[model samples]
Structures are given as C-alpha cells and as structure tokens.
Target: MRTTHPHPTNAVEPPIAGTAEARRVSPNAGWWRVIGTVLGIMLLLVAYYWVHKPLDLSLVLRLGGLLLDLAVNIALFVAGGALGRALLASLNWAVVSRGERIAFEALAGLGVISTGALLAGMAGLFRGVFLWLIVAVAFLIAMRRGGGSWLVDARAFTRALRPIDRWARLWGIVACALLAMALARALAPPFAWDALNYHLVGPARYLSEGRIVPAPDNFYLGFPQLLELLFGVAMSAFGRDTVAAPLHFGFGVLGLILVAGLVRRHTDVRAGWLAVALPLSATSFWLLFGWPYVDLAVFAYGAAVLVAAVNWREHRETGWLVVAGVALGFGAGTKYTAGLLAIGLAAMIVVEARSRALRPLLLAGGVA
Candidate 1:
C-alpha cells in the first residue's frame, strides 16, 4: 500500500489506447449507421406511398383492396427478406449480428401472421393500417441494427452493380442475346397455351372482381399469388394490353440482376456473368420468360437462396442461416417443386455443419 501511493496517472491508460485503435479501424461505422437510419425512413415512406395512395374505388372496395394488398406485401416481405439475408451471409459480410438475426426472423414470422389476417378479409382499414404501421416500424428497426455492415461495405455495393465490368465483352454478348430473346417472346401471340389455360386467365378473373376466385377447372394446379397479384395490378393499369407480357420479362431481368449480384460475391466477373447467363440461356427459361407465371419468382428466389447459403458458409452467421430458411419457405410456397430444392439445400447445409461440428446449423435449421 505504501509503495502504490505514488502511482502514475498514465499507468491505467492502456485500455483507452486500445479503444482509440478500434475507433480508427472502424472510423466510418457511425457515419454508415446514420446513413442507414435515414435510408430506412425513406424506404418506409416510399412503401407507404406505394401501398396507401388514393385509387379509383368505392370506400368498401378500397378497404377490401387494402387488405388484399397487405397480404401480398407481407408475403413478399417474408420471401424477399429471407432471400436477402441468405445472399448477404454467402458474401461473408458480418452485417447482421446473432441477436439481430433472431429479431429479423421473428419479424418475418409476424409478416406471416399478418398475411393470414389479411387473407381473412375481416379486418377493415384501421386494422390494416395498424398492422402496416407495425411492419414499417419493425423493418426500420431491423435495417438500422442488422444492416449496418452492408451499409458500410461500399466496395461490395459497387461491385454488385458492375458485375460485368471485369468481362465486358462476354457480358455484352449475353446481354444482346437476352434482349433478342425478350423481343421474340414479347411479340409472340398472347394466346400461348399456358397463357390461355390458367396463368393469365386466373389473374384476369381476379382483377375483374377485385378478389381471388379459384377456378374449379384448374383446381388441381397450385399457384403462388405473388406474381399473379402483380400481374393483376399491371393488368388493371394497362387494360390487358400486349405490354403486360413485358412486365414478366422485367421480373426476369430483375432476377438476373440478383443472380449476378449473388455470384459476384464469391467469384470473379467471368464466373458471375456465367452464373447469370447460364440460367437465362436454358431452354426451359426461355419458354417461361415472358409468360405470366411463377417461374420468374422461383428463379429469383432460388438465386437468392444460393447467395444466402454461400454467406452462411463463409461467415457462419446464424442470421444468414435463418434467412436461408425463410427463402426456402418462400421458394416452396412459390411452387411445390421448389420444396425439393429447399430440402436438398437444407440437408447439404446440415451435413456440412455436422462434419465441421458447427453449431450454427442447428439454429439455422430451426429458424428455417
């Protein structure tokens, strides 16, 4: 005690030095966080405008329409969020923490609950508005906390946008081929066999009545309403014009973008371009390219799942695993065949994790 009476004030200052080093290494982290918060608010506002704006309809009909729209939105959110998480995980970005991933999954489950309520159609405008408000809040919170790393990773963001930059010549050829395919598909007759059968007809019926009316003739077929509902909205806007087919093409294009972005995470530009081109070049893909069907949705969701699986493998993040599960669920919901893909992917993940004695696989499987 007597010897310690004259201790220097700087003796215990090393902890502060360590903290300063951390700040220097992650200097822009706070700024990135602030930007994320602002962007989150903007997204919420955009979502509200897109979903809640005035439309030409009676009050009762508008109320009913709101409920239907809410259902579709919730479903897309669950599927999209899951796919996004899996993709991010594959990239090995520690954007989301473990607790954040759990919370995100919980919010996604809540979206399912909201979907059930919206499908019931018993809830009026007030209920719909309340539910949507909760969703917006949850989304904002999740993005702010779980998406920080993504926001800060400017290099990854730039790379995703220009996946073809490294192989410009090859990508140009692929782009031209895709364009030609799109033009051919769009100019073709509207009464393609499937279009006449159920794809367009089912949604056309729904648009006419502003409600989902299943056709007994096609009762054996299972269709996910995500794309159908979108087609219904587009049909309402364009009055069944030939241009509606191009909308499906647009979705396919978006799916291609997602694939490119996902592949770019793990491979070089040439490999990523191949990933995007191979799927589009498939004959089966061209057959369904412009049709108003669920194939594009499946493609999009599948690409998303692949990205997520890669992320989970690289980062071992529980959040990515859960997100992969959600994506799998959404893919399964889109088409029954997708269930097989989901199951196979899940098994692969489980086996890989077990071999390595990784614990996150259990958590991911449970969430998925």
Candidate 2:
C-alpha cells in the first residue's frame, strides 16, 4: 500500500502515536488569532523574565539574537552533514554498511561543529549570517548535484532496528524522550554557573576582541576550548546565547552510535542492539543534558579515534590512522582527559598487533 502526503512539509505519520512528528498547524488563515496568541505568549515571557530580574531592550535583543545564532548554526550544520554524506560515499563501504544514515548524521554534525571551531580562528570578521549563509549555500549546491538521501538511510536504519528486542526498543524510546526534554529545557536562557561565566562568555569576548587572547582575571580562559570554541563562535556570530548543549549532546549520541557500531562489528545482532539501547540507562549520561561540560565531546573524539584505529588495523588504511590522530588531537583540545585516549590506543595495539602499533602512535603523535 502506498500512502501519499499532499503537503511535503508535513511529516509522514508514524505507526506509533506521539513517537513521530506531529502535524503542522498553519497560521496563514487565522492570522489575527495567531497574532493574538503570539502577543499573549510574549506577555507570559515578559512576566517570567521580569521575575528573574527586569525586562529591557538589551535583554530582548540578546534573546532575539540567540534565535539568529541557532539559525546560522543549523544552516552550517546541514551543509556539513551533506558534505559528510558525499564523503562517506567515497569511503570503504564497510565502515557504514549497516548504519549508513545515522553515521551520516553523526559525521555531518562533526563536520559543522568542527568547521565552526576551525573557521572561528580565521573568521574573526566573517562570523555573521551573511558569511555562514554563503558557506552553507555553496554546500547545498554541491550536495544537490551529488545524489543521496538522508531519509532513505534513516528509513533503512529503522527497518534494521525493527528486529531488536521489543523491551529494549521501548526502553530506548523512553530514554530518548526523557533526554530530549532535558536538552529542550536548555532552549531557555542558561541557568548553569559555568555557562554564565566562561563556557559561553569566553567565546563572546573572544569574538568581540577579534582573537583568542589572554583573560588575566578569568581562570577558565586558559583552559582547553575545543567545545567552548563552538559555543563562543555561535554567541559571537549571533551576539547571543546559542545554547550549545544540544550540539554537544549530538556528540554523545554519536558516541552511542559508534560504540554500538563496534559491538555490532564484533558481536551478534542482539548484542549490538543492546549496546545501542542500554547506555540510556546510565545516570552519567543524564547529567549532560544541556550542560556546558565537555565530557561528551571528549568521549566523541576518543570514540572516533578508537573506531578509526580499528578500521586502520583491519584495512591497513593510512587515512584511518590520520583520522584517529586528528580526532585524538581534537579530543585533547577539548579536554586534557582526552590524552588518555593515546594511552588506551597504545594498550589496544599491544594487545592486538604489538609490532605495528608504533606506526599509528607516531602518526597520531605528530598530529596531536
């Protein structure tokens, strides 16, 4: 049976209610009612912010700019994901044979977040929507010319998970929903202390000052900034709090996927699904909900290094070695704990293939 959606923008209905995207509500016909509703919401918001401090134009502008920052960041991320999909097509198909779509989402996310950090160094002047939009449009054009579908990969991914244990499936859904709500709360102004202090402020200052320079008074200014750099870029570019936790959260999800992927690669199907589903129960994972901490980013970089290390070992591909090194370096840049990845990699080599471990270690050493 074929089902057709008359409106392309409307989401396809899911088999499970509330688990899928809901129908869109258009305000085109009830324009006056929509205006009244928006005004009412604005009044409620004003009351809330007034309770915290007071309502003012400066605060309003800052809040409004956050929206702009999120928009620019999302645009750049979509472009990066498309580029990743294009690159994945060129890589050894085995790397993404089973989880092609989710892998693309992870890789694409890494692309955008990494690009923001890498470019922030050079883009002191070009941190506006104009620059990001141009960068993003160019990618969209390039990707349109190159054919592939994220949706197709997503559908396939769902199909593969259909065979997973039903209990695991239900638990995973519950975990995902709870986590999503946690991240969603971050959409409001930052309530955490670190974010108000340096996690977000450092980047704002850096962008305003036109370079990353010393902050004599601020203690965290000297700390490693792999993840904070992205936060700062979004803030500086948009002149507001961009709520970086969700982007950071994506890294954690990518970690889950990569970890599950390795399990699937080495173990059975059921075990692989368990690997994918079981991590949501961890209390540690819940702590990261919209927090400005860098643990997830560190985990992601380390996971990338590990996954690449395994790939290089099996395929003897120098590119994977280089990737592992870059990711390790990025991890270290995010947090000092990432240095542990190098030691872990060394131990992995000693256990798996002692003679050749030094080759990758040296390569990763130079990059890190």
Give the alpha carbon lDDT tens digit for every residue of 202-297 in model 1: 656655544565577786335654455444444443345343455456446545655665555555667666766776677778767756566766
Write candidate 2's Cα lDDT for 100-149 as tens digits. Answer: 33553445445445555556555554354534554555466547845236
Q: lDDT at 53 for candidate 2?
A: 72
lDDT of 2 at 211: 59
Stretches of candidate 1 above 4 Å error? 1-167, 187-189, 241-244, 355-368
Best by lDDT: 2
For model 2, the local distance difference test gives: 0.65
* TM agreement with the true structure for every prediction: 0.55, 0.69
Error of 1 at 128 (Å): 16
How far is 308's C-alpha from truth in model 2 (Å)?
2.0
Question: Which residue pairs of candidate 1 clash?
Answer: 86-308, 87-307, 87-308, 89-311, 90-310, 90-311
